[model samples]
Target: MTDSGALQKFLDGVVVDAAVFSLRPDYRAVLLPVDGLVPGPSDEASEALLQAAEASAREALAGRTVEDLPHVVAWREAYKSFGAKPQRTRNSLEALLRRAEAGLPRVNRLTDLYNAVSVLHQVPLGGEDLTGYVGAPRLVRATGAESFDTVAGGVPVVEHPDAGEVIWCDDAGVTCRRWNWRQGRRTHLTDDTTTALFIFDALEPMSDEALQTAADDLAAHLLRLGPDVRIVRRLIANDMTHPEGT
Candidate 1:
């Protein structure tokens, strides 16, 4: 199937188990499936964006700490709800904030851009290579049977999420474990990815307007990546709201 077709199909099958909502009714995600993008190593443009994000992070935390940030506080509680230790396994947003004091990793153009955007909006965002996914994406409390590919001691290894730990997965296995703590190697974005999926995770204190603003900022940056870039977005929550493109 084409990129758009596959994304639409993925959206059709997207499921956030009711149990997950029961854990945190305020939890929501902004799923953006985009195609027709060029990809390359991190360049000066991405570097500039990253620098701006670093400054933004510093400004946001000038007189405060990551744990004191409202969004980070909300996410920490959310992680605890699903049996994960927040301090040990910080959410993506907290992880980025902590790293911003030094410098963010310059992975590649796409990854760097999204990381910058995530930091800019103070939201947890994840980008994946759509081609690496199997079946449709799902958010559920893991049963400990799904495989999670990763590197350990510089060697590749497979692990599983703890039973009842919230995870993002597909038919093949887990794509992300502990909600947003870590992304699997299988679906991680790389320089070769032309079509990608970006997920923005939000919780209480992050208004819908704020989430939409973040999504809009991300889409704007994405459209500048390539001439033919196309994006479709949807907000998945109890109401299952969809943006215009979706």
Candidate 2:
């Protein structure tokens, strides 16, 4: 299928808005829509990619700690600005880089691949199962009223973000909390996911070119899942007055 055909069908009635970027002018996000993925256990090619990415991450972390990394440090500050404790709720990139020092978990093909890319590029990346989304996915400062679905103890519980906290949400609830620290269980990726939405988040210290390269690398790795996979991407920046298609 063509790019437009795939994106139009997958994104039908699904609007993704990055409203937080308007206020936090230093923020940048790149959205990647992918279709026709055969998600399952990692194949030989994907395994090799993950291995190489882990090795690269280890080498990159040799002399410096995660806190010393420019991108990680920027994200920590961003979290603090919004009332999040970076020491407790570390950003996704920091978490992944730390895990890579020991070993990255092999969750599934898509998750493993994105986790690797996040570590390799030193950017916060998230992959959500698009099919599980209720409506639009938005990044906005919460009003302490938006619902967030997560697990409490052994049971599923519904929670809400603190007022003015930066979060990613849909009509159903928050998808990610504190920018990239925690992802809700509602729209998480799984082995059954066929279509996916990947978010690449960057801050001031991180350049646009770096974000683009990370997205490109992710798309390339995702294509390894299947032969007929199609991908489309859009870059949302602080300079844009309104989000695309809004």
Q: Report clashes for each candidate as comma-separated counts.
A: 0, 0
Task: Choose the strongest candidate by lDDT.
Answer: 1
Segments of candidate 1 deviating more than 4 angstroms:
1-5, 240-246
Best-fitting candidate, scored by TM-score:
1
The reply for model 2, stretches above 4 Å from the true place, is 1-3, 6-19, 240-246
- At residue 50, candidate 1 shows an lDDT of 98
CA shift of 19, model 2, Å: 6.3
Clashing residue pairs in candidate 2 are none
Q: What is the lDDT of residue 168 in candidate 1?
A: 96
Q: What is the per-residue lDDT of model 2 for residues 197-238, given as tens digits with 9 covering 90 to 100?
A: 999999878888898999999999888778879888877665
lDDT of each: 0.90, 0.82
TM-score of every candidate: 0.95, 0.90
